[model samples]
Target chain A: MTPARRRTRSSAALRVLFAFAALIALTSVTAVVTHVVNTSAGLIAIRGGTESAATGDAAQVLASWTLLESMVYRSVIERDAVERFPDGTRIEFRSWLNPAFITGGYSADPTRTGVRGALIGSLWLIVIATIAAVPAGVGAAIYLQEFSAPHRLHRAMRESVHLLAGVPSVVFGLIGLVIFARLLGPLTSGAIFGVRATRVPTGRTIVSAGLTVALMTLPRIVIAAEQAIGAVAPRLRLAAFSVGATRWQVVRDHVLPQAGPEICAGAIFALTRAVGDAAAVIIVGASTVVLTDPSTPFAAFTALPVIAYQWAMRPDPSYRGLASAALLVLLLVVVVLNVAAGVVRLRARRTR
Target chain B: MTQDVGVANERVDTLSTEELTVTYDDIPVVSDVTVGFARGEVTALIGPAGSGKTSVLRALNRLHDLTPIARVHGSVRLHGKDIYDADVDAFEIRRRVGMVFETPTPFPMSIYDNVAWGARMHGRPSELDAVVEHGLRRAGLWDEVKDKLRQSALRLSAGQQQRLCIARTIAIDPDVILMDEVTAPLDPISTGKVEDLILTLRPDYAIVLATHNVQQAGRLSDRVAFFLVDESRAGRLVEWADTDSVFFAPRDARTEAYISGRAGSDMSARGRTG
Candidate 1:
């Protein structure tokens, strides 16, 4: 065959292979989604009574499978109700999008396991963690990248920082448990500041958890900030220097301004990790069933990931639904944060 | 302006180097080069690549301090004071002697802020607007950028950016200005504009320009210093003379051959003579 004909044949074969691969992916995704929905619906049916439970479970399974519920009703399940199969197995299809699911305080009772407190707690955790980590991380990065001499000590310092970033989150959690929870209990619990101390001196409060998360995030932020600061062109610094600006002046006016958006992006990424982290918070003693809003950073708190982890560990179908809903919320928060960071990065690029 | 010109010229030596040697990582690039810049006059350093013209210019304002490996020996005096003295602050020296680079580097800020940054760093000037306007006008960029002062400096074209950099350098009102091939990367038209700016600025500030472009050195400089890399690849001053004499009756054979475009082979031959 001619080269053109051979090329066309090969191209057609490649297209066919791509189409086959796509079909396989689509099939696997559909299968997994169907299995999840059917299993949830089946479990709900066993708990729900015989009459409306079966109808609701059937409708839910169909809705989840077809994705029609989202398009039509903007939800997977419309209301908290029960239905049953002919054999007397029951199912409960709770509306995951209900305000009560998000706003109600946590309880052992699956119906009252609202994520409001956990959501608020996660937000506080991220905010406090970001506040504590960004400056410290960026400062360390600046020192290492700009000010520090290229001597053996600085090289060792850089290597140590990289090593810190590679350390497991559990190690940081252990540190938090020992230091923030045990050693600095009075300070973290605000007992030293003359505030009313109602709880034990375990320091298993929002402040402790936030600090732990901050420690977990610090290494990542420092590495990212170093890269961002390093990415700035040397000529820009020289330009600042030539204008008679001091070292600090050059860094503040030129380096920081140019690297700010990227640093922010890195900080936000670290915050996202802190927000989703469960292992570290768990070790630091964050509760999975917080019933009230944390009034202060010193107050005991639980985060969304902790709550989701708790629900996921349960065998109950309702708990599974709650966990799924919590995971969805976590996903939404991450997406929103990323989009905000993207917008900031674009604005920074435009200005530069 | 007329009175300022007369006052500026009255000070004969604005800045001078005494046995200046610059080493980067223990290797000397500029060795024992002594030169003086007269007030209100343009002094040009002309050389082939790697002859340390730019390095010498940088050393004048303590720009070498920024490079960790760079070690500057000997004294650089500004107004008869050793700038490199232990008690002397490099920051103060840099403020008094501003510099422009081969490439335009405006700060990532508004055009107005880019020009005003130097003044602000010195201690926020009370008359910031006037300073920005004066610097921009002096660099020949005010008419184009004045209406859009709030716009980002990076948005300016390459030539405008270079001029903005010049404006930024001049904003602090330094006693001397160092230009290291400031127009090398620009188009001929932009080079002409910058050359015109240098000529216009000659009456107000002591200017040290480093350029390999022989015609540019001859055109704008009152005096020209020829530097060459010896067999050791260390830059040494070959000749320093008035522009007229340097171009017409060069005392050094190397300088003469360099001006006549026959220096390439002569330079390699002279490298063996070292």
Candidate 2:
């Protein structure tokens, strides 16, 4: 080879070598940073918060502590309280007098203040938002991608959907507050069950928050669903139609199955956004004193973010520390959910 | 078979076309072209790209309805019945006049599903599994894929995929098979296999094929329809005659030049076979 050609080949090889080195460096840095962050956040210490040095149920052993303690806080302390078995080994105990056991206390029941309530509540919001947004958004996307002919009018509508995605979550909250919380709340509440259907003046209830988040997340589902549907080869669609498949059957069989995983991933992302969002709920009017777990859509409740926000703003140092822990819990929940989505997407791609 | 051939040739002698024209958006692509496909015979359509060979085949099958912009100026009749009659359904036309594409366009499904798709779509009775198997056998793919009927059609080699497509078209038991360069995108071995299959299948179905390969036309078809092209002008049918005569004694000099390697031809010269 000529000198110039040899030099060109050498440079190409050098560029590849540099890329490999950069990748290795990045991986090492990421590993080290993750280790540092995990250790500094006191993951193990958070578990220690539930441990107690005192022995026995407060009502059975320390009647004094039980008598003076509020039902909510005392209930939690009693549940975690330790007792020596007859054989002399100590173990944690649960008590019947705990306010969480019978009536809602701090966060519905203080005795049950583990990740259970946060998990169940987060799942509630996520599932609700997914149910509301995924079908509506993905259906719209399929219609646009497969059925709608390209023209100025259709193009404008597509652009409008994209623009709606750019609108802020707070804006969606304002709209939801006006529409779902105020206008539709009483109507739906009265229709479902007979009561003086009440709507909170501040629109931060779970139902309002979920509807708001669904509106905010709808555009993402639509865009992603369109992309997934578009990824199916045009020839397949032609084949279906040529075989006398109705437009509906073509979308149902050839388009939707191909797009299903992507739509699911979009739903998962939207759900994560809804579960982790605090600002919209704050704007709408979330409650601080939720004495019971949310069993009804209209039930006033405290979600993880709202609770974390309240705790973080408090003047007490211990409460701030508690808020930091809650923040950690929230972060973990989002990461786990996103990772699950990633796994599903990867599996679908491999099969395709 | 000889009696059938005698009758088919008599029909060919009497068959005629009247003022057939195809236009897209008021622009005539093929105009005033009159042609007839001989029954129970292989008729090769040889042309350059954009010469409307495949378009004519599609019009024959009433497949032009798939393209919303395409419009035909005259009627296409099969056995003296107008293909575009008001009562005629495109689906019925497709059932009678099947087609295979230039490229192997198998569905992203199992091999059996690929062949069974047409039969199922046409509402064939149950026992389509047997039809699928029989089609595969006819297309000479059954022995190789009998054990892997459930395997994705896309997983097959290029040759197998092409045969799978052929099997798919024939599963509906079409009276005519319109193939648009069905063997162009294949290896020499695979091309030879398909040529053999075509000759074998001619006894069962009338075959109309469009191909860029002059040698393939000479070797496989009975009658060849030559479509000629020139820039700034719509394509036209230059000649239609026996394949052997067309190859050896073409009426048009351009056709002669195309068949022999010595002269200019519209086809890609990268992979020529004498």
Candidate 3:
């Protein structure tokens, strides 16, 4: 190749190399920061946070610390050795990510504490948000982009969607607190469903908080979904219309399916933003300490982010370590969801 | 100049317009234009850009209904019935009078579905495979896509995709087909293929095409309507006749200038105000 062409190709390769390096640096920074914070908190809890020096919990914690130290020796470690009696009945697992710490219910003791209540409640919130947000956001995006007559009101509404994105997440929480929690208290708190006691309901239910999160993420979903729909070729719509498909049919069969993957990717990102937010749910009346495994939409709930925020603020150093562990769980979930969205986008592009 | 508005006889015309006027945002784009398309014949609308060739073609298919600001002020008749009547469904009218666009438009679906989609919409699912094959065969795309019916239509070349769009349009068996510069964006070979396909379709359906390519019109059209911008900045049908008379005989000086490429240079500057 000529020198000029060779220079251009080399520059392109260098740009790609720089991009990969930047992405790797970003991931490494996050991992390193998390490790430092979690390890420092664990060390503080072990050295200064235990209430009584001679308590059985402290002794067990020390014993587990010794086993954890041995784990550093890769070639010499007991991968699975639970405490057991001579009769071989297993006593317990001695690890941070043990089943007790993942699935066990509410606990005051540090050894047996788990995220089950927060985990299940957060899942309920996701379900509620998906149900409430996807239809409204996707439908509005399609309608506004495809069917709305382009006049002053139409342009104003489209412009206001960007303004909505500019509003802080906490503002939506306040609105939800007023509208869904106070104004619609009877419906959200299940008082209308006969769960009300003699006292008035507070409306601190999963559905209310979920709706708050849904409201918080609505604009982002709309923006992303609109972009996806707009990216479709005009020729496709004309072709569908010329084939005698009705307006609804054109959107459903041609436009929607073509834009599905991008829309889903946008929804996933919007949900990721919602899933990490604690301020909104807390403002909408999530109770971190009294969290229960929500059985219905109207039940009181606490999400992982809210509980982590609460734990991280406790005076007890032990709670700090637990907070880091909770955050690690939340982090894992976010990573999995983001990866799924990437795969969806890649599959859609491949088909195109 | 000899006017051929009489060619669009009420009894003989398969598709005809009577003093059709199209306006957008209260501005007339095409004014008082009357034309007809006969069965098994090709009619070409030739004009400079922005002179409302596309707007007139869109009115024929009732596509202007999709645009909120566009209004039709004259009657469009199909099979002796006014299509713009209060009772006539625009969707049903469009089904009977299909359209193909300049850009290749294939649905984001399997090749089979693209051809079968219109038929499926009419609630006729019987013999879908046969219907798809017949449509593709007529559009000259069956042999290229037969083994890969499940492949996405977008994976085809631009020329092949254009043919796929043609197949998709014909699959529904509409009585009239409108083409707005269908081969303008294709390579020469693909353009040739599409032109040949249009000739094959001419004997089976009434075809109305809006084109800037003079040779394609000369090669394929039986009748030609020459449109120009009037002093009021609205597109008007200045000349209409058999291809030979409009091209060879003395008629309107404007049509002669356009046919001889004399008006091609600055006509577009006037067309913009239209």
Candidate 4:
């Protein structure tokens, strides 16, 4: 074929391919827009106390929101309690968006779901996990990056840490179960702190969940801290050394300052992962349905992810909305943590 | 060959090395390098790349301790005491014998803090502000950076950062200062500023400078040491003498060739004869 004719033929074929891709994109955009425009966040077939598609007399309390029966109507739903908007998104807020729901507990009815217990349990998990992981992870990173020579043993240790980051979170939960819950039950169950419990408190407490999160977060923090440490300019270390600073002194004053923001950013991301993790919390003894908030660290506990996990798996279709709402709350927390990570990263860039 | 450099025995030296040899992983890179730097004088170390000038500078302050595979033999003495003795600490020696690197390294901190950091590392000085001012003044950086002491040192230009490094070294109050091609990364104006700083510092401290610039060596040095690589590719000290003698009346044929541009090019041949 001549050059012009060959070019024209290829251009025609490219035009057809572009048109096909454009058509697919347009269709997807339309479908998404239609769903978003037609559906409401509060329109999930939910009733406060009535099983509505309203044509049938099949009303069940479990299909409605978590509110008192007096506050709800046959179909008007949480009419004057929790909150009622002009647009009829009444019971939606009572069960999933109100202060009561956020600060309350769970029941078998699914309509009475609240996440205060899980929220507090998650806070405990994160606090203990930070205590367990940050120091250990940062210290290990410093030693590996600054002190440890690239010999066989240190190399093996480094590689093992990287491999640990790849291990499933559920495995960390098992480790927590075997070690904290069974072997060190007294310590983990807070009996060592002289707190009295009804049954001496089983190993499945906030302590076990926190330690499990710690274990899973440790490898992530180490990996991130190592990368941050490695990115530090070698020139800075040399400057510190030439000024008569010792090895540890260099790491503390210069290296650590330079790498701090990046390390903190990494730690936050790792914490986010641990906070969103469910399987590990479950395996470590956090029940899917938590009814009470533990007053002390040694009491039985549950996390948001665990609650979401349990509710989403219910045989009844109405429980699915509650599960999704729980998940959205969990997602909000994750988003907040991710925003924290981004802030740290921006600060790091500015300092450098 | 080193014994023939008869001019080296003249001064009351502040720092001296005897039969010094350095090796990396058991392979000798620089061998039998014996030289001295007298107080109130600048000793310029001129040589080609990979001839071990930097290695020697690193050895002077025990900087080689940072590398496991690098080894040093023979004795380096300061004020008549061998610094390599086991009883002596590397930190103590480094504090006494400071170094300025080829590239400027300004810490990500305030200008005042950069100058004061070294002083604080040893022990917090009671009068840190006065000490910082003195060090910066001595480095010729006090006036330029006086108003911005609270700003980050990293914001300074390349030359200002280098002077800040000098100020940092001075803050520790060292007896000797090593400069490793410090002006190689500077513009002409900055080079002039640093060279002037070196001249002012000459009367108070023993300075050893490694440089590829011949004219700079002639202008800034009182003494010169020329290093060469033999067939074995191990660096050896060839000549050491007063700057004028080394530049105007080189005794060694190789030094003459290198100095006169007959050895290769000026950039390639940096040796000056005793």
The alpha-carbon RMSD values of the candidates against the true structure, listed in the order shown, are: 6.3, 8.3, 6.7, 7.5
Interface RMSD of each: 1.0, 3.0, 1.1, 1.2
Residue A98 CA error for candidate 3 (Å)?
A: 6.9
CA lDDT of each prediction against the hidden true structure = 0.82, 0.69, 0.81, 0.82
Least accurate stretch of 10 residues (summed lDDT) in model 3 chain A?
A40-49
After superposition, the stretches of candidate 4 with alpha carbons farther than 4 Å from their true spots are A1-42, A46-100, B1-10, B264-274
Which of the numbered candidates is closest to the native, going by highest lDDT? 1
Per-residue error for B129 in candidate 3, Å, reads 3.2
- Give the DockQ-based CAPRI class for model 4: medium
Order the candidate numbers by TM-score, best to worst. Answer: 1, 4, 3, 2
Q: By descending DockQ, how would the candidates be arranged?
A: 1, 3, 4, 2
True contacts kept of each: 0.89, 0.11, 0.80, 0.70
Q: In model 4 chain A, where is the ten-residue run with the lowest total lDDT?
A: A36-45
Model 4, B1-274: lDDT tens digits are 1122225446777789998999999877888999998778899998777677898999999988888789999989988789989898888889889999989998889999998988987656788988899999999998999999999998999999999999999999898999999999999999999999999999888899999787899999999998777666778888988899999998887776666656535424432221
- What does the lDDT come to for candidate 3? 0.81
Pick out the ten consecutive residues of candidate 1 chain B with the lowest summed lDDT. B1-10
lDDT by residue for model 4 (A12-126), tens = 9999999999999999989855543332213232343443324443334323333223133424543443343343442333344446557767755554557888888888898
Q: Is the docking of candidate 2 incorrect, acceptable, medium or high quality?
A: acceptable
Model 1: per-residue lDDT, tens digit, A1-352?
9999999999999999999999999999998666444332222222432343335432222112112343344332334232223332334344554566677876565644588898999999998898899999999999999899889999998898889888888888899999998899989888888767676465888888899999989988999899999999999998888888888888988789889999999889878877898889989988866667888888888888888898889886566767877776776788899888899899988755
lDDT of 2 at A262: 77
lDDT of 3 by residue, A290-311 (tens): 5356777887778889888888
